[model samples]
Target chain A: MRAEETMNKLPANPERATLEGKNKFLGFWFFLGGETVLFASLFGVYLGLRKATNGGVTSQELFELPLVFIATMLLLTSSLTAVFATMSLKSQNFKAMIGWLVITVILGFSFLGLEIYEFNHYVHEYEHTIRSSAWGSAFYTLVGTHGAHVLFGVSWITLLIVRNFGRGLNLYNAPKFYVAALYWHFVDVVWVFIFTVVYLMGKVG
Target chain B: MGSHQNDSVSKHDQSHLDIHHKIAHQKELKQHIVSFAMMIFLTMLSFIAVASEAISTRFAILFILVLAGIQAAFQLYIWMHLSHKGHQYPTWGIFFGIGVAATCVAAGAAMIW
Candidate 1:
């Protein structure tokens, strides 16, 4: 009876209230740590081979500021929405949490759409296929890996929302949402570097 | 009988704590908005530094890199809650990864020339 009563009223940090939740939180961060290294190596490779364009096109010619800026804004806003969702989850406002997450999912989709369009434009208009040049190979591999992460995040969150629609918020599902949001934010963090090192620097040179 | 009475008292206290938690959450909401705004401003600054002809290429590169570092800090600390309590292990784990990553980048870049 006591446990049931306490369960109904969320603890201060519902995401870390249970042993399982705490484990998930710690484990996910470690996973993100590994992911950072993975991306860093790819970044290193891209930076090394960025100048080898093989006479097709260069970074300055192929990358556009406008499209990248729009995509960055979309992903950044989605990260904020995910934060809001986590906040609502803490306050035990089930509907508010879901509302924020739905908005996040929408923003994620918009960002992905923009990326797909950007890649399509690059391939068709610029002839910048991965096989075209060493620079192209490195660029696509690095950015494409990041894109794959975005796709994974979008799919993960959508499944979470669907699977738990009937169940509402509970301890079992709270950590799931919290960890997913963290993953989403990490993806945004990677993009922050991508835009800077890949896009802006490419433009400058 | 005594246990039942104590339970009631704790329940009363729990309700009091809930109010405080809500107030704290409201404050955190403001922090989130401020951080987001700051990130947007920094991004624009980086873009302008590159887009304008006034800034030299070498300087623009350095300036934008510094801005990116600042923005990444905001995302990690504020948005990702790395500054919050109970994140000590996370701090260690991520930093270690960053250390390895920096080495990898240095090695890869050095191979070019």
Candidate 2:
């Protein structure tokens, strides 16, 4: 009777029930706030130095709109997939949530792969190494940091799936999945800026 | 007698949960689909503005930046559900981050290269 009562009292969002989960939720937001500052600084630097190419290949010569546009679509769609997974979690469908999360991770990996190819092509084709010019250095460091976040997100979600496989949607596991989805969406937010401030502005300027 | 009462109580809880969840699912489904479609449209519009020469260079930059801002807002409020109830603190957290970020942009602009 007691166990059933506890189960019966489970809120729609089982994730936010416990104190620990609430703390995790709020603390993670603070961390993301700090990340916002970090990225902002990098962005400012990239803006300041993007034109100081020291006579190397210019950003205009290197950026292809079609490729960057496709990558942007991939990450944006992944954000929506993560949203679906969160909805599934709220609706108490663990299987469907996990399925959507798997799709999110795959899209993340694809974005990372495209980024790697983009950087390699620039370095080889235009001799745009970080050491080549001030512009090159700012460009790589700023965009590379965002790519690293994507790699980290993909790995984090993969580990969560592996560790929680066969585990039902209990309160403990619910918060874990919820925060991972949060982190994935945060990564998507950063990418929206990257494609805008970095790629789009680079093309325009 | 005790066991029979327990059985009835559990059944009642199940029925209540089913009704509640069904309504919520419908509302959330519409929210997600609408936001997703809007975000995609905004993205395509920005891309087109940049690709086409109908707009001047400076206007295009401002136009796309505004689009990006709106898209980010959609991702935060809709996809991340920050607009939902009981999200007061996290909302503060993100806005605080944005405040600091805006300051950084200002400082960086003033510093110049």
Candidate 3:
């Protein structure tokens, strides 16, 4: 049977669709919505505790714009690559989709690596640790949560690519790919906020 | 009976075509790129505002927060496609989420202050 025939045989309710596909798709988006709130709360707490640095290290003394700019570029470029991958998926160009996803995954990994390096530099050079003060705790919690999302996104996309390598795009997998792209975009969205509230505002303050 | 048969035949033909074969409009991709560029520019502008030393710290904080708000709006509407057609549910979900977030921020700030 053709792919459509296979999909047709699947159920209607998205949550109960065969291949356990649509269920994961709708469920994941809802999960991401919850995650947005989780990050939002963290951001609120961070903003409230922003001035609680206890004279450990102020924002201007700690943050370097160039490194952050590079990291921002990496993540923004990754978001574009993810869009390309989704486009390829829509066009049924599985090979091209996979290629774009590979690029996106690499960008995400490099972004995570840079974030780790950035954190280490802050801790070692600036003596900024999560335990340093309330600001340190809030800073790490907010930005670290975003970093964790990026790390999760990288791993999620990598797993999707590996699991669906031999299998081409079908309804069973299309929603999965679509939601993964959505999650990637969400990560980028959160970073945009982080860049503004944490880095830029921190610098100004 | 004959009309019914024709209807079934057409449905059969349509079902064979995969929706994924449709190419996304190039214009949409261009729009996304433009929006991404705008957000990057906004980010840089905030950085410049902070580094300039011309603005007072209080004003700088307020200005950067406004810029951040604008960038967040761009990311949501454009990158996340939250404002697009067929995304009504997600749009509502995110807005409701933002409302709660704003309240939390206000209350949290108040409590801490």
Candidate 4:
């Protein structure tokens, strides 16, 4: 009985307890590193063409702080919830982890909704769009790319939760949960730049 | 690799390990909450820096960018667990990406002129 108890015990970090888990964990970070470069290129293009409004609405005139602020808050809070999910994963509390992930997904959806509303408002009210001008194209591409990421994250977490609802926490699925949380956090990290360079910087000018 | 030895430990020792893990996780949780609060404060500060007319455009841009850097560090190191042990390779990967990203941003800025 004692031997079985020890055998059944989970490692402190069940996610990286095995070679496969370790590989998944490291590979995901490397993937995030690659993702950083991808977004950086987009950011570069946006910066170069940000001034070319081509008689369309300028960034300063088009951006509203309250909307952007709310979106940032939503995403930032979602990042925290994802962290909580990770903590729960570490402690092997499958239900709490799912609960936290659900909250994270909800926040992600809220952020995406705000982005859609913001884009629609810009198009209808100010005529700013991807086809409007260089600046318009740059703005939409950079911010829209981020919005798409939020959508992807929301979907990813939802699927993870649903698919794993019945499969309790174990080494097999623990790394998956950990990796998903990492991806969600990476999404938020990208937004930190977006809000700073795209929205906040645009407002400052 | 050595985790197999854990199977030989008595049940009482195993529970002790579990308790230790729980205590450590609790402490880590508190630190994460503190980091979260700091991030929120920084975000608000950046927004206010841009919203107010008191700060010049040049200064506000620089200030907010700095804040963004700090906030990103907090997320990466604390929330992402990059600060924990066994993250050496992950750190290298991320820094390399950031280095290349910096070059890309510089190139983009150079195109502006």
Candidate 5:
């Protein structure tokens, strides 16, 4: 009888509780930092090679400020939805949290769709393919990397939502939800830079 | 002695989960919503800045980039919860990584420039 009670009340395995979760959290943050540098390098390359447009489509001519601005707004709002989901998690409101996450995923998908259409429009309409010039290559590389990050975030969140739909909130799943929200925020941060460096700066310079 | 006893009693009370804590959490959620609204407004302002013909292109670019930087900081600190956490080591690690990346980008640019 004593053994049964002890087993029931055993503190959550520290390996799973503090150590492993903390390691995953810290490692993910480091990974995001690495991503920042990856993006910074691409931005630098894009800046230098920006003028080597080979007299093809130029930033001033090709970039449409209005469409990019709308896309930016959509992504920024989705970041907020993810925040609400995290808040729900903190309050142990599992249903509310899941609801917010689903909303975030939808917003993310819309943003991705818009980006795909924008890229296609630019390439087909403006004759600005990635293979056109150094500028085109750098442009696609930097912005494409960001798009890939968004796609990854969407997939990550979707899987987490489906996996946890029936599990409910417990110590085991709380950290998973938390990490997914972290990834969503990281993607938002990257979009912030992409808007500034690629869209805003391109139009200006 | 009596006050010390009261302090311990209150501490015990604080340890117990209650509805007040949930209410406070909801209030915090409202603050988060307000922050999000502010960010949305700022994003729209940037769009206006970009679309307007009167604004000098150079100033428009600088304004938008600076605004994006501010928005990024807001998302990281508020939404990501990095600011409240003990993030000193992580901050240093990421910044150092950025430094190395900057060097690589500079070198690559120089080679191709």
Candidate 6:
């Protein structure tokens, strides 16, 4: 029984307690680093074309602070929940970790719902489609890419939870969960910039 | 490589390691709480800076962008544990990636003119 307990409950760094775990952990961070550059390039393009609105609705006219604010709060809170999930993972509390992760997924879905609503509102009310202007293209590409990322993250986490439902937290699976949590946080980090650069900056003019 | 062997090591060895891990976890938990509060506050402050009209719009944009930077750093280091020990390679990978990102952003910006 003691040996069984030991097998499951590894160390605080359960994700990196083995050589394979170490590789996965390091590789994921490096992947995140690469992702950083990918997003940065998009941001650069968006900044350059933010004002070329081709006689359609301008950002200042379209962006409503309240909706964006609610979205930000939802995502920010979700990031915190993911952190809680990671903490629970460290302590080997499988149920609590899943509980927190589920909350994280819920918040992510809420944010995605708001984003979809925001996009639909803009399209129907203002006809602000991607082809409307250069500004429109940049805006959609940058924010849309981010929206795609959120979609991917939600799918990723939900699948992990479902797939691992039968298997308790073990050495093989902890790294996967840890990296998923990291990716979720990275998603939040990206949104921090998007809200600041895209939404908040767009509202300024 | 032999994590299985490591796992099979005597229970005495693990209990010894567990004490240190418990202490480290306590510290990490406190850090998470403090950073979460700080992040919320920063987000609020950025929004307030924009809504207040106390500053020029351009200045508010710049100010909030800087706040975003700080928030990202906090998330990366504290929440992601990028600053933790044994992360030296990840540290290099990220900073090098940042260097490339900076160059990419700058190169893209120059095409604006």
Q: Highest DockQ: give the candidate number.
A: 4
Per lDDT, the best of the predicted structures is: 1
Comparing candidate 1 with candidate 2, which one achieves the higher TM-score? 1
N/CA/C clash count, model 5: 0
- Model 1, span A7-96: residue lDDT tens: 465556778878999999999999999999999999999889989999889999999999999999999999999999988987889889
TM-score of chain B of each: 0.88, 0.84, 0.76, 0.92, 0.68, 0.80
In candidate 5, how many Å is residue A71 off? 0.9
lDDT of 3 by residue, A102-180 (tens): 9999999999999999999999999999999999999999999899889989999999999999988766777778788
lDDT of each: 0.90, 0.85, 0.77, 0.89, 0.77, 0.88
* Interface RMSD measured for model 4: 2.2
Error of 5 at A69 (Å): 1.7
**TM-scores, all models, native as reference:** 0.95, 0.94, 0.84, 0.96, 0.85, 0.93
Question: Tens digits of per-residue lDDT for model 2 on B64-100?
Answer: 8999899989988988889888789999999999999
Which pairs of residues have clashing backbones in candidate 5? none
How would you encode candidate 4's per-residue C-alpha lDDT over A26-47 as one tens digit per residue?
9998998899998999899888
User: If both were scored by TM-score, which would come out higher, candidate 1 or candidate 4?
Assistant: 4
Worst 10 residues of 4 chain A by lDDT: A1-10
- Could you report the Cα RMSD, in angstroms, for every candidate shown? 3.0, 3.6, 4.7, 1.8, 5.3, 2.6
Candidate 5 lDDT, tens digit per residue, B33-59?
887888888788777887788999888
Who is ahead in lDDT, 1 or 2? 1
- Sorted on TM-score, highest at the top, how do the candidates line up? 4, 1, 2, 6, 5, 3
- Chain A vs. true chain A, TM-score per model, equals 0.97, 0.95, 0.89, 0.96, 0.90, 0.96
> Which segments of candidate 1 are over 4 A away from where they belong?
A1-7, B1-12
Off by over 4 Å in 6: A1-8, B1-19
Q: List the residue pairs that clash in candidate 6.
A: none
Docking level of model 3:
acceptable
Q: How many clashes (backbone N, Cα, C below 3 Å) per candidate?
A: 0, 0, 0, 0, 0, 0
lDDT of 3 by residue, B8-80 (tens): 3344454443331232346667888898788778878777888887878888778778887887787777766
